[model samples]
Target: MSYASIGKRLLGLAAIGLLTAGLSGPAFAQKTIKIGNVEPLSGPSASVGVQGKQAREMAVEEINKNGGIKSLGGAKLELVYADSKSDPTVGVTETERLINTEKVQLMTGCWNSAVTYPATQVAERYGVPFVVPVAVRDTITERGFKYVFRIAAKDSWWVRDQFRFLKDMQDETGVKLKTMALVFENGDWGTGFAEKWRALAKKDGYELVLDEPYPSTASDLTPVVTKLKAANPDIVMLVSNAADAILITNTMAEMKVKPKVTVASGGGHADPKFLENAGKNALYLFDEVEWNTDVNKPGAKETNAAFKAKYGYDLTGESVDAYVAMYVIADALERAASTDPEKVRAALAATKLSTGPAMICSYDSIEFDESGQNKNAGIVIVQVADVNGQLDRVTVWPKNARRAGYTPVFPANK
Candidate 1:
């Protein structure tokens, strides 16, 4: 069936779920629960932020159409948006405005880790529940804030898995990788990943050929790529945003800097536009992500098809997390049965969601720990390849999760 039809079918199933849940009263339309969303709507990170926004809109539409909040007489969720412009100061102000002015009952977003770090602080201070979907900076959940909950794997986990994938691939291919390079955008997210990469590289006994961090907004990444070429490490690890991701990939290709292995941490690298713009340049690059279109989950393909039908692009890891965050919020609200902040916070803390649309994630379940981190959160590695003449991401690590019939090119340079 076509993706559009599949999306329609999913909506039909959601309606069935609503009926099963005993949703019946038209009075539910009388109340609308406001969810504050702070995002980088028009800045360097805007592309990713907009992707998150679209994903949330899709989830919210499904929920409202099906039943709204059944326990609250089916009250629909209304998203209130504030553009952070990828600025921390703007994030802080927008978050406060959403709470005090817009009067949102709960909150989400500010995809940039730097913005999310402080914006979540504002949510915690005001006692509003903030459900983070994609910001991976470990510190976001480590601050002991009761109101902040993260749905994605932390940067530490991401880094850990990156190294694991590298090791597993080496073992399987009999390729001995010795030297490594770390190149990332100089941001909270990138810096955080770099810190972990440094320790892991040392622990694994790999030589550090080069370590460089560049501005995400830099117009020219040729200098960094030049350094990378000179260092010529066996493996090159990167952390970049959308625009810079394209620039770096193209620049590396242009400069003929082909490392034995090129790995990306999935910010801009996972963006659909990254694939479109980077094209063949991104071929054979490995990226760590929470979800992929080819993931083994049941509903993943249909959901991605629907999202692509609507948005004209496949869902990225960032968008998938944002999509799941809405369901998490809905589940909490369903249990809480009220917009009361404390009750919602409590319900969120007790989340053990294992079914429904949210299960479309690569992981089997969603549950938070004491730190408000999703303890069940996991990551997967995918390589860019040509499937049926289309450049696409194919899951290629962890043995079982690897896409069938496709052998990965470990060292594409040779």
Candidate 2:
């Protein structure tokens, strides 16, 4: 070979080597932010957990499609899900595994307060940024943990909204609520709601005729319903999960235990499955919900339409809350511009989302307080309404958020 040909060959080989390194450098440097998502996927709370997972998946998909955290060079979010089996201890164990074994930097969820309460402790101990979606126990954010954040309305908000709705009913319809009976599941979620309601009831000058707490796993609620029937209070306020909600509604209908007002402080009461299981029996039942599909909130209708089109069912409060949680985390990640847990925590604390898809909640905005609770978080009252021969969830209280021309048929006239 000629000297000129040999020099050209050498130059070509060097260029090829440099090009290979350039092509491989960015690919090797790219990072994926792993977020741990813990929920009860196989136990009593499986339905809610499943919906939450779907919401998270949808949010992550959307974020990725929109270029996946623009500040981080398009680093995609990788979700690591662990099933709590609807057990608190299991939730804690799964969370630990996700952090230690899976090496996830941030974490979200365990739908039930029982699971979230303990699971969040695990996240706190690990210094992982934990964002709670649907768990409403006030104590979840009261633990003085810097890494934990709750973006959903707490138990006190729900109970207070229930009273506000009661007052509205009396003022607008001349329905005097003299006495109330409290029946709740014996768990962190239920107990927190019951305690808040008790305090609010006293302050609001409402008489409490009966206070009952039952096991969440009980197969039948007849005993509790029997006691409630005997009390025959003017209003029966129940805090229960989906299964128990169905059982209570069925027992009440069968025994003809009718009250002037039957209210449920969210939890299972607001779940779409409750209506599916209770059918017409669910009519006239009032519920205090963090997010309702029928509410007049910005981006709610479009979001619900997309959710229904994708999932083939109406979006519930639990699902939407989880969806919002994902957005909050993505927002924080984008602001932090780094995967460092502490930086993400700080960014989350500084988050202020108002009037956008991220503000899909009932609240006007998303801003966490010192206690890691969303200060702007609020609840609205919704009632099962029959519209065009179909039972629909309709916002009926807080005149500002209520659907126009929709009147709640109290006492259901069944």
Global lDDT of each candidate = 0.93, 0.86
RMSD of each: 9.4, 9.1
Q: How do the predictions measure up, each by TM-score?
A: 0.93, 0.91
Q: lDDT by residue for model 1 over 98-146, one digit each (tens)?
A: 9999899999998999999999999999999999998999999999999
Best model per TM-score: 1
Tens digits of per-residue lDDT for model 2, 1-414: 999999999999999999998888667756778999998888667887888998888888988888898999998888999998888988989999999998999999988899999899989998999999889888999989999999788887777778888887888887677888999999888888888888889998889999999998898889998998899898899988768889999999999899989888877887778899999988888887777887667788898898889988777877888988888999999999998889999999998977547777777778999889988887778888789999988888888878898877865542
Residue 96 of model 2 has an lDDT of: 92
lDDT of 1: 0.93
Worst 10 residues of 1 by lDDT: 20-29
What's the residue-level lDDT of 281 in candidate 2? Answer: 88
Compute the lDDT for candidate 2: 0.86
Report how far off residue 363 is in candidate 1 (Å). 1.5
Please state the error at residue 181 of candidate 2 in Å.
0.9
